[model samples]
Target: MTIRIFRPLRVRDFRLLWSGMTISALGDGIYTVALAWQVYDLSNTPTALSVVGVAWFLPQVASVLLAGVIADRVDRRLLMIFADVLRAIAIGVLGVLSVAGELRLWHVWVLVALYGIGNSFFYPAYTALVPQVVSKELLVEAAALRQFVRPLTMRVAGPALGGAIVAGLGAGAAFLIDAASFGASIAALLLMTARPVIRAEGKTMGSVLGDMRDGVRYVLSQRWLSMTLLAVTFAMIFFLGPVFVLMPFVVKNHLQGGAGGLGLVFAAGGVGALVSSLVMAQRGLPRRPLVVVYVAWALAAFALVGYAEADDLWEAVLVSALSVGALVAGQIVWEALLQRCVPSEYLGRVASVDSFVSSGLVPLSLAITGPIAGALGALVTLRWAGVIAGAILLGFLVVLSAATALQPRPDPGRA
Candidate 1:
């Protein structure tokens, strides 16, 4: 089992892509720390922090469908490279502005919007590209490996290092590091020889919309897929804002912690996620993958309630670790299921719609989280949000459990 966990690494293309993505994930962790702290430091308001989330999500909401279409029509590796180049340039400029002490809230917002746009294009292509590089028998192992590396680098090492850098040097240094990481990712993409599963087929402007509509119809036709997406959308709407917008404030105001403390909290969560990923990589999926996914997600939501009630930094760290561990475990299974079930021809579009729907309400949540926290208090807001999300997820678990569509169908290779 242990040896099998590393099986995906033997594939040259997956290995190179994974290496680049791991480096990129580390930069993302650093960028997240810098962005959150820089916003709070400049404006000293929860609303200001919320604005950053809103700015990033808005462009994603608008551009994701087009991104999905483009991914399906062209070489996904090239699309990812283009996105990385754009992101690298934007972050580089942001680092320069920050170092010059000429940075403003609006400046951050604009650059983040650009970053979000790039992400919108990159993610769908990346998700669809994974199976192309690895054989079907190795899909679960491949996803598990990625889940492991992502948190280990992005969450554990990245945030911890970013925190130290922000404390010792400045956020600008972290941003500069993030910019350089994108170059590594682009190089990896250039080295990949994977071909697109779906080609343009002489695509026209009208056919593009038709393709998107077909994608939507495909999702709707699957009861399990639609229901799972519906549940996730609501859960994200209720959960994401409080966690992202209020956590930094919880560290600074409630716990009297610094950037280093916040970094420690994130790193702890990464450690937990890393452990979960390793376990999943070894154990593989359960008999009922969907059931395990929903139950694990529900546990994660309940853990957030613990986070909201924590009195000190260590308490938050412990709770966050538990939550992240469960979340990552569930996600690994979920990704494997999607890769196995969804047809390769429409995988890019399906994955994009999945992302779009799950994140569709995030901007609204961010917009409201600040005002709600300001009025109700951060702890109260976070606690209640967790409760609501957990309840919703439990309901989803019940529904999915009873649905034959989501039940395990025998896969000779996997089982």
Candidate 2:
């Protein structure tokens, strides 16, 4: 299990991608801390912080279908390389502004929106690109290994390292670090021996809205994929969205803590995720991935509901740690299932649908969270979100159980 962390490095292509992703993820960690702190410092309001989240996520929802179409119609490696370069430029702009003493809230919003656009492109391509690199038999192992590395970078090393940089150097330095990582990622991508070839060419001047509709229709046509998307989409909106948006408020209001306190909690969550990743990397996933996924979400629901009732910082942190573990483990399973169940030809389009639905509702959640928190109070809203999410998830579990039980098995002789 310990050695599983290094197992993916054995494959040449996967190793390159992993290394690049790790470097970029490190920058992501630093940027995340700096961004959050910067937003809070500038506005001193939770709504302001929430707006920054909206800026970041709005682009994701907007660009998802376009990103998907491009991923399918162009060389994936080129798409990734372009995305890395564009994002690098955006981060560099932020770094330059900060260094020049001209940084502003609007500047942050613009840059983050640009970065979000790149992210929409990067995610679908990256997800689709994985199955092309690894053999089918090793997909679960590869996905688990990838999931394991993310927390190691962003959650654990990212925030802590970013905090240290901010404390010692400045937020400008952190932004510069993010830029450099993007450069490194682009270089690694350029070095790939065999880049994927995309061959869908009808017309370049077609309507983006129509393309989006086509993507959505394609996803809904499949039972398993539709169900998966529905689950993840709602999950993102209710569970993940609030958790991220409210973390700062939780630290400031409830824990009476500072940036360091938030960093510590995130680091703890990282540790929990890393531990779970290690287990999955070594043993691989359970045979019935659907069951494993549902169970993981069930655990997350419990963790959040428990967190809503925490009496102290330590109790909150404990629940957060558990929730983080479940979240990452479930993601690992979901990624593998996408690779296994969705056809390669439709991977990009399907991934776009996955991104659109799962991420589209997030900005809406962020937008509404502020108002809801302000009206109902942050603590009350937090508690309500947890309870509602848990109840919904339990209902999903029951329905899934019934569906699986009623599904007829194929005859052995037919095989």
CA lDDT of every candidate: 0.83, 0.76
Error in Å for residue 229 of model 2: 1.8
Off by over 4 Å in 1: 33-53, 96-107, 163-174, 199-206, 245-264, 308-316, 369-384, 408-415
Stretches > 4 Å off in candidate 2 = 36-51, 197-211, 245-263, 367-384, 404-415
The RMSD of every model to the true structure, in order and in angstroms, is 3.8, 4.3
Clashes of 2: 0
Candidate 2 positional error at 224, Å: 1.5
The CA lDDT at 353 in model 1 is 86
Candidate 2 lDDT over residue span 305-375, tens digit each: 56557667777778778888887787787777777666554677788787787667766677678888889
Using TM-score as the measure, the top candidate is 2
